[model samples]
Target: MLDQTIKVELSTTKKQKPNADQLQFGKIFTDHMFIMDYTEGKGWHDPRIVPYQPITLDPSSVVFHYGQTVFEGLKAYVTKEGKVQLFRPEKNMERLNQSNDRMVIPKIDEQFALKALKQLVSIDKDWIPTAEGTSLYIRPFIIATQPFLGVAPSSQYKFMIIMSPVGAYYKEGLNPVKILVENEYVRTVKGGTGTAKTGGNYAASLKAQEISSQKGYSQVLWLDGIEHKYVEEVGSMNIFFKIDGKVVTPELSGSILPGITRDSIIQLLKYWNIPVEERKISIEEIYEAYDKGLLEEAFGTGTAAVISPVGELLWKDRKIVLNNGETGPLSKKLYDTLTGIQYGTVEDPFGWIVTVE
Candidate 1:
């Protein structure tokens, strides 16, 4: 059920207006935050909008030991009307519930979360950046709190929503990035917690990403565990390939995450009459198509980055260049269209825009 006792206490940095340019991707925090706690029998309570501060926890907390936790990411924007808006927060709420189901985190009312978050944002609206490609990043996470030595899920949990100001994914501009195809390590496997937005998945991919970065690549193109031929994803984002004039992406196979940006791209492309296909994309097909000049485009989609074009992919000693080392026409079209809708320039016929005011 939705927690009704809404507490309020503004942060000490309650300024009239924060310098928008000071945001350096989560370096600055907002004046308020949302927090709630849950226990096995008591459920979720103490829904509050309080000052942003550090959270104290027991050293033996289950989350500290076994790492039974889950989290979500979403953003809030400031429209030209000087009012705040969120892009389909209900979807994030549902995704959080799905994560709870997978990790055994207790479920709280989504409406209550929406209410509490809105209150915090309303109180700290000045933190929202007005610059292009800038936003107020919202992160909601739940961690096990009960101190237990057993290897089981904790009975107590803490859910929190912290906000930070972020700038464009690429500070200079939207430049195409090179990706490394990592065949050595698998990010997630079938029947694993790949579909959920839990920390372990990201942790497993960190080593691979670090290796790729150390070798001069921006991200890694992961493959399925069993065959290692099917393309899975790119870092934390979903992958897409435009082959033979048809856009193809790996279908969600329980090991793949269904990103909001990926879904939005599919919908927008279909609306524009673009042939977007969702199927199992094989690495062999991509490499062969690159040789045949059929692979027109490739990109990664996620919340942090709306669309990151893949200019080159290094698989072992062989390098595959996508469409001659630049962003494809279709990739740019989708990026502009999606961003246009988000910034309220074009029509939002799908009813995806949810105004915060």
Candidate 2:
């Protein structure tokens, strides 16, 4: 069993907090962070909150050599009443363990991890941004710390939770963004670490993302690695399409990261009586729908952007515009509802909010 008590140490000198309006994503960090260590025989031990500082690791750490790590992202929102709360943080802990399982890392106690996260957030509650579309981004990650030259899982590990006050993920905020369909460099295939939140999967996408940026695209739309025909997901988010008055997203085919926001949006749509489906969707099919004037809107969902409307999609030599290159009605509604619940303006009927007091 994991330790139930966590040690807290306040920072001696506080860092200057940035203006809420000037905040950028993943830039400014809080004063303190949460950390825990894991050993093969000892298991996880010494849960504590310490002053934010650099961590010293061996040069031959397993993470540097073999890239064995898993991470999760969520947010803490400050309501108008000045209460700090987290949105679906338990889901992030659950997903972290899922990623750990895939990466051959020891499992963490999910409830204890959530407890530690809540404590950390409570200590730095003031860091939660109050500006519109601003929140404290929480990153919980685990890394292999054992010093070894072998190509295997490390015997020691470190699980840490750090936070940063962030503004909107995209400069456009809720506005739509142009996406390029990547045909050459695939993100990942089945039976790979694509489903896991590991660094290697993202490192593989940098080349494609760099090429797409030069083409004036904000993100890349990835296809299945095997056939390279079916739509998988966006670079940083899961994708959804409004076709013929129905919502469609690609099914989890073991090559896609199961996003917590994506699942919530699907559930929200169903609650609102909107038609939604999850299946293998091809790029050709999307184009076919566009040709018939049935493609109405396209959007991406994740912890960062929440809902990123796709204004345009460029697949090969063909391109199609969605909803007149504006945010769609459904997309806006989803964004408003989700954010409202997050910021405590809207009633959370889904019980997704966890208050930190």
Candidate 3:
């Protein structure tokens, strides 16, 4: 277990908070952040909450060279009754350790991490945006800090938690988005870091993302790395398709991320008695479903966007439109229910909420 005593050092100066109406994703940060250090022999120590500031690192830091890092994202929401809450934060911590294990980083105590997070959020509770579709974005990450150019695991590391107040992740909001299917580059393959929320996986996606953006697409839909035929996931979110009347998402086949939002939606559907399936879904199969008029809706689920409806998908020379290029009813309901539970307006049947009192 991590040391329970966390040293708190309030910031001596504060920056002006951005207006709620003008808030943008990750562009602004709160006044404070939480940090902890890990050493080779001594393990993690010196947990502290201090003013948000940059730290100097050696040019030969392992992170800069080998890219050994992991990160997780979640949000703090202000309820209508003015209560602060988090949705299934323990799951994020669990995934963080999973990523850490994959990257050979030391494990962190999930319970202690949650406690530290709650304290950090409680201290900066004022930064939680109450505007519609707005909340405090929480970023928890770990990086290899050992100043070495070696290819092996670093002897030192830093874990941090930073908060940002932001609006919607996509300018389209709940509106549908256009996706470009990439056949040139793949994100990751099974038995790779694709399942882990690490920087390398996202870094590998930038090329496809850049090209897709140039083509006027909102995001890139990646296919399996090996055959490049099976559907994997979107750049920043997990993809799902509602065919006919049943909901289907790509199965976690070791290459796809296990999204917290994705799991929540699956459970939500089952709770409501809505048919849902998780299995290997191929792009060609999706196109076939669209041809048969079974592809009724498509969407992506992640921490940033919560739920992003897909209106159009471009693959090779074919372009298929879904739900007449508008938000589908199922998409909107999932969004409303998920967001409602997140913001404390809906009854949380799964007990996923963790209050910051």
Candidate 4:
């Protein structure tokens, strides 16, 4: 547990808030942010809540050179009863620590970190957007600060949490998206930082993302690094496929992100008594399923989109359309149910909702 209480400092001058109806993703930030520092022997100390502003760092920081950084994303929703709540925030915290461990960064007190997050969210509670499908996005990240040119892990680090009020991730709401299977440029190998929420993994995906965007696809469905045949993940989310009335997703093969939303969907499917499988699923298998008319639906799961239904998938020159290029029934049901629980319109039977008091 964190023995130190977070010091609060309010901003004297606040920036003009954006129109909630016109809010975009990650474009605007809240008034205050939470910050904590870590030293080699001192561990983490001096937790504080201060006005959000520019941060200073040295040119030789390891985070810039060696990419010793990690981050987590979650959201705080404004319930129908005018109360602020969080959906599976502890999972994000736990994942953050997991990322930290993988990146050779120091571990954090998960509960205390959550408490700090709650305090920060409480301070910016008004920033939580109230529009339909709008919510306050929270970003917690850590960066190496040691101003040395060495390639080793930094002894100094800074952990910070920031908030952004955003609307829907996709402008078209829960509509389906077109995706391209990336045969070139592997995201990461099984022994790499693919399982970690680090910047380098995302940085390595920019080229493929640009190519996919130029090809008019919304995202790239990545294949396994070794064989380049098995489906690993989507651009930034976990991929799922519905074949012959059964739901299948790629298992956590140490190279795929273990997504919270993905886990929730699995549980939700099981709760509904639907067959869900997590194992190695190859692209050829998907095409075979399509050939047999068993490919029912496809979607991606992540914190940003929650669930992104796939309408079309292009692997090589062969293009396959799912659900007649419309959102599948199961996809719609999952989205509605997930969002309902998030916005407090549906009953949260799994105790996943955490109210921000």
Q: Cα-based RMSD of the predictions, in order?
A: 1.5, 1.0, 1.0, 0.9
lDDT of 3 by residue, 279-302 (tens): 989999999999999999999999
Residue-wise C-alpha lDDT for candidate 4, range 1-357, written one tens digit per residue: 466789999999887888867798898999999999999999999999999999999898888899999999999999878999899999999999999999999999999999999999999998998988889999999999999998898999999999999997766678899999999898998999999999999999999999999999989999999999999999999999999999999999999999999999999999999999999999999999999999999999988889999999999999999999998999889998998999999999999999989
Q: In model 1, where do residues sit more than 4 Å from their true spots?
A: 15-22
Please provide TM-scores, in order, for all candidate models, with all chains considered together: 0.96, 0.98, 0.98, 0.99
Q: Would you list the C-alpha lDDT of every candidate in the order shown?
A: 0.86, 0.93, 0.94, 0.94
lDDT of 2 by residue, 1-357 (tens): 445789999999999999977898897899999999999999999999999988999999999999999999999999999999899998998999999999999999999999999999999988887878889999999999999999988999999999999986655557899999999999999999889999999999999999999989989999999988999999879999999999999999899999999999999999999999999999999999999999999999998889999999999999889999999999999999999999999999999999999
- Given candidate 3, what's the lDDT at residue 90? 98
Q: In model 4, how many backbone clashes occur? A: 0
Q: List the residue pairs that clash in candidate 4.
A: none
How do all the candidates rank in terms of lDDT, highest first? 4, 3, 2, 1
lDDT of 2 at 301: 95
Candidate 3: TM-score? 0.98
* Candidate with the larger TM-score of 1 and 2: 2
